[model samples]
Target: MKIFKYLILLVSLSVVMTGCEKEFLDTEPASSISAEQVAETPAANEALVNGIYANLRTYGVGGTTAHTDYGHRGITAGLDNMSNDVVLNNFNWYIFFYNYTGRVQTSSRASLIWNTYYSVVADANIVINGLGTLENRTAEEDALFGQALALKSFALFNLVRIYSPSYIGNESAPGVPVPDRLTFDGKGRGTVQDVYNQIIPDLEQAVTLLEGFNRSSKQQIDQSVAQGLLAEVYLETGNWAEAASAANAARTGYGLMTGEEYVNDGFDNIGNQEWMWGADIDSESSTVYASFFSHYDSFLGGYAGALDGYKLIDANLYSMIPETDARKDVFVEAGNEFGFPPLSNTKFVDATSSFEGDYLYMRSAEMYLIEAEALVRAGQVDAGIDVLVELVSSRDSGYERPALTGQALLDEIYLQRRIELWGEGFAWFDLKRLSKPLDRTYEGSNHRDFGKFMFPAGSNEFLFQIPEDELNSNDNIGAGDQNPS
Candidate 1:
């Protein structure tokens, strides 16, 4: 709560609320101004919305920490390492995340994840709450309002997914706090069902408000982005029919990138046609050594390369990828032995030698998979297979419509998702929602600790504990509220 209060003060004082600058969010700290005294014009209001987008890039989630990316990049890397798809070569940085050893109630990563997201949520709440005070609203104002709502919903959804149990049957389980107003007091955690209930309405409002609003940048939220988020939320809650409809709607104007495009492109550019939403990091805004490319890009002599390539693709997963699939070449087949796994992932690399590379948040391929899975879950097995065919054939020309039904079809979809998404960050979330076991005790597993690697289904490690800072500072949240250590 203290952290939240401090951030609110900084935001209120730093951001200029009067005349709008094209890169208003990029400006350094200036004279303090009251929120009520600014944003009177559409341009100023637009600048306020732009502040949300800027926060999405450089706020708690995107900032650099010591040896780690520590933003969305860090979260994704941690989640990938937690799963069996990614293997760490050394017990160096991120070893705690890979091994799940120090993910306690007071862990730094847990604190960063929690604080960063709520900071975004708090900013979004200010924009959303302050919108009603102005007079003669235009379409521009409505668009900004919708974007703020969607951003808030996105942050809340992420927080709940990490801190609470799966929503399948544990809807009543304790979830992260839902702070709708711009207040400093700790609101305390809500039930998983309560958070989802709040999230659904925000997304619904976002979809309606964003209709026909052509966003100038991929960083901004639009109708498609809102629908995509809603589809994901619906899928998580097991609303199969609604999930399918929303997923299909979300893929309206987007198409899957060709296999060649996927392999050749660095997967770092925000301008890719397949990318739905992303952060366009440039040299000016790059975190240098602590950037996404520095960690994940194997070609760069950064963290991944310095340790003789720590971010490796699991051998089991690498073997499953068909030789015919171009994606199979994404990792080193065999050659260098860094005293660990040989199949290191080379899927991500910077466009240049510099550490600057755009970060991807969402893509169209995920929508197709979402639609396919939702269709199968809704009892439309054949329809699901057809949708899967469209996505799979695009990636692997040799792939044919297989003679499979029921769980087999679902399994194939899951496998395709694993291969397609890979380090783009869906593995741990999928494992959580599907209640899958994490068995890293295989003979050739690259996990540093065998004892902590094999997490069974429904393990307590699935939920991250609430940070100790929040527990000690927030009156409503205490030690009893923490997730199992």
Candidate 2:
């Protein structure tokens, strides 16, 4: 049952494709088959691109995946053990508590994540390579190239962070399998530097491709998306000035949502088209709920608003949030209705008629926060603190966290990020990037630690073990592909 549950995520990945086939035209168009035949048309290209997004919701190895949603079990449990949050359930939360030897195989989540990231990249590759072949490529084709590049870069960036440790001033960290922009075959593990190198080029090209390209709605990636991603990259690389500038640019196009808008109907996500980038979910087409299969949804008794005691928010972080903030509602917490639900962490699961919600990849708040953080990091302390204070003060009403700078301001901003971005998958990413410790706790959370890490800050607990299959099939890597030591 332990391993079998992982299969559920894989099953979800398979269904992301629109299985309904469209019959070919009855005409005599058998002249030849070209890559353009698949992507030159909007419908075919859209379907191809959609397939990648669908697969992205599966579990593990980075960025956006079903793991973000499903990990709630392991995550809730893991956090609970460390005292960060309270677990509402105990079904199987202990799996992560210790390290053990198990034959490695590619997980549905890892492979799907790999496939999604690359397939999307491949789609972008197709856009890059097939543009000339396309019947009417035009500026839209170039815009897609930019979108594809940004998407691929984002996925690669996340994949690298999950599979590899922080740069740590050394270049040898075992990053995930990095693929060449032109290949379709699976490659072995690339070094952290190798993976990092691939991203900047793609993003740089994407920025160039998306010059002046603007398409509203977070579902479609455009110039702003490119800028937002670049800012994130710069921040990660410690290029504070460039990061701040890029983030500020993205902020120009978007910013924090209004109090009411922040808590949309129930889809309670940063996406919902307000996203700088996000997944478009169709109830019929997306079985996100099936993969999520959690108590946080409709069954728990009301996590955010109701719960079954399956998951909760971190106590430390939870305590830090001011009472006046409207964003505080994002977490239900232990004392809310029964105290078992702990913190709500419902920033992503915004479903009114259902327990599910449309997911977002990036949002305006992130851009705003990035700009603020970048400014502080770049020595623009007052400028940066102002940004953080504005957002927090607005959210918390009467609260003001002081004009903090250095570690204090950075920590302040990060806590809000965790609270604001919790459940949407940024928790692990942030921890991994900053190399923090995981310390989650709960009454009945299912996941446990590999060793002694707590809730949301464990080492590889932040990253995932590379699925074993790739190592066997390719023989270029090994069982424990990530979270080294």
Candidate 3:
């Protein structure tokens, strides 16, 4: 039920006349290029693709100037706060997420998530449907078309996961509406299967279309990224073999960072050896205080550093790391000089301590873990163990391959994933996909008392409620179509 209000505003601004001369005011703006013309020009099509990527990092896409309403990363940080691994020292920015109110139908977080991703979907559709038929597409057109399809799939995948139940057993559950065209008319909530039917095919086509397209920068989606995304979708659907194959294919050329690189180098660079996909944030495009590092990086001069917004790791999870593990160095120990929480994270610091810290969306390390997990789940325990060993050995020199098999080995990979990807925003989705509960009430837990919530597997709290605005505005989604409170 999210409207294209921002799109209308953007288009309106494009044609606004700025000069005072009568001739200038009367002349047609270059922005008034027809859709057919745009479709026929490769550069124009590329520019449109660039706009879609720009919106991913742009501030205020959630229809508000609220500090917590930045684009994709905003929703990601909120998801991590909802998980058990992250502990906020004090409630200032993402308090609703920590206290479990953000997912409610009436909360701003619900609307923010719904509005932002749907806007991406709608924009991608403009590029996708605008292109002419498949027979005579140029190489550049194929690449541009592939990027649009990949972006659409990425947005829809996140939407379906956030708004509905996990895909394994709830295929028939109602999911967010899938709008294939640029229209204002309300669309009904479709089945979970219906959304995936669109996502899977889109990703597959994106991979094929992007086959030989080498991107000049990491901000753009290429074939490997598309394949990695497909591996994730396959993993969630329990297609273990397919997941393993696609993950292996995706991580072929990317190597794991050495332990020194993992520890000393601030994780704010897209050029890092392990990084496969990330935002290339710079001064001109920086969102200043409304950025990922502002709320998460303790060394920055923004919220986390200046206002006691220290993002801490759960004490129990911190305790699980051995002294030999390099990953443990990222979190501070108790009685630190800064007077922050015992395990406040230093993993996401900016070396320059500026607002231009880059945001990492995916890395080669994730592909290895996914490949390992899928292999183990598919009963290739020995191959899975080897993959897991290769990854963990890079982080912990003293570590030897555990003699475990089956569930024990699988559990170890899960632990590694938790340690490696802590604040990069996979926590809540991981918990939901594995059908695990959010249990923060354990003894010696560092989770704040007010946020020590316990929700069992398959609880209604795991799913975000469809925002009230959607219900009131979309005639197709009535009271009966709403998710249970």
State which candidate has the highest lDDT. 3
Give the whole-model CA lDDT for all candidates, comma-separated. Answer: 0.77, 0.54, 0.82
lDDT of 2 by residue, 180-203 (tens): 545445566768778778787788
Model 3: per-residue Cα lDDT over 266-329, one tens digit each: 8889898888787777776678788889999888888888989889999888999999999999
Query: How much lDDT does candidate 3 score?
Result: 0.82
- Candidate 2 wrong stretches, greater than 4 Å: 1-33, 36-47, 57-88, 92-112, 132-137, 260-274, 291-295, 298-309, 333-340, 345-349, 440-463, 478-485
Deviation in angstroms for 113 in model 1? 0.1
Candidate 2 positional error at 316, Å: 1.8
Instruction: Give stretches of model 1 more than 4 Å off.
Output: 9-32, 38-41, 59-64, 133-136, 336-341, 450-452
Choose the strongest candidate by TM-score: 3
In model 1, the clashing pairs are 61-71
Per residue, candidate 1 scores C-alpha lDDT tens digits across 105-152 of: 767777777766776687777677677556766898888888888988
TM per prediction:
0.93, 0.76, 0.94
| Model 2, residue 393: C-alpha shift (Å) | 1.7
